[model samples]
Target: MSATRSALPRQALVFLAFGLVQLALDTAIYVGLTAAGLPVATGNVAGRIAGACLGFWLNGRYTFAEGGKTRLQRRHLLRFILAWCALTVMSTYLLASIVTGTSLQISWFAKPLVEAVMAAIGFVVWRQWVYR
Candidate 1:
């Protein structure tokens, strides 16, 4: 029990570290696409796709690698895509809603917050099921 408790924090820290990189990648692509006059949904999808690809490998290779042991398999990739798709849909809807309600500038500020919330949920899913 203690081991599991200890592992959670360490795993969370590593996950957060990798998540920052993913967030940055996602945001940059999102901003670039939106600035180019793409729709919010399109930009969000592009960004999430870019980030998700990198995130799967990083988390699988390090954060959730079962003490640096498990190599990523096809199963992990498939599971990751499923999870990513769901999360991306939610993210796109939220961003689109925000944009519809307010301005693109507001949506820009809201992007990180949206992704942060999504990341929190994603961490649990990845730890408990996706990577497991």
Candidate 2:
């Protein structure tokens, strides 16, 4: 039990590290595309796709890394993608509801709250199945 508890914080730290990288890349791509005259929608989609790709590789290589070698095996990658997609879909609905059914303070709280829940879910899936 203690080990599991310890692992959770470690996992979260690693996850957040990769998440910051993803956010940086995503923001950079979005800003660059918009500056180059692309529509905001196009820039947003392109940035997200780029960020997702980066997140997968970074998390595989670093976040959930085990042993000494890289954890970029194809099976793990596929499972991670499937899990991430499912969680992302879930996040969309939850975020939409939060935005629609809440006051300003609550709505403002939606993103980090949703992201935290999604991160916890992702960590469990990754630790137990994706990278196991």
- Candidate number of the best lDDT: 1
Question: For each candidate, how many residue pairs have backbone atoms clashing (under 3 Å)?
Answer: 0, 0
| Residue 130, model 1, lDDT | 87
Tens digit per residue, CA lDDT, model 1, 38-66: 99999999999999989998999988877
lDDT of each: 0.90, 0.69
Residue 123 in model 1: lDDT: 94
Error of 1 at 33 (Å): 0.5
Pairs of residues at least 3 apart in sequence or in different chains that clash in candidate 2: none
lDDT of 2 by residue, 1-132 (tens): 876556677778888888777766766765577567775445545655777788778877877775555678999988988887787667656644664687323533454556567767877888888876
TM-score (all chains, Cα) for each model: 0.95, 0.65
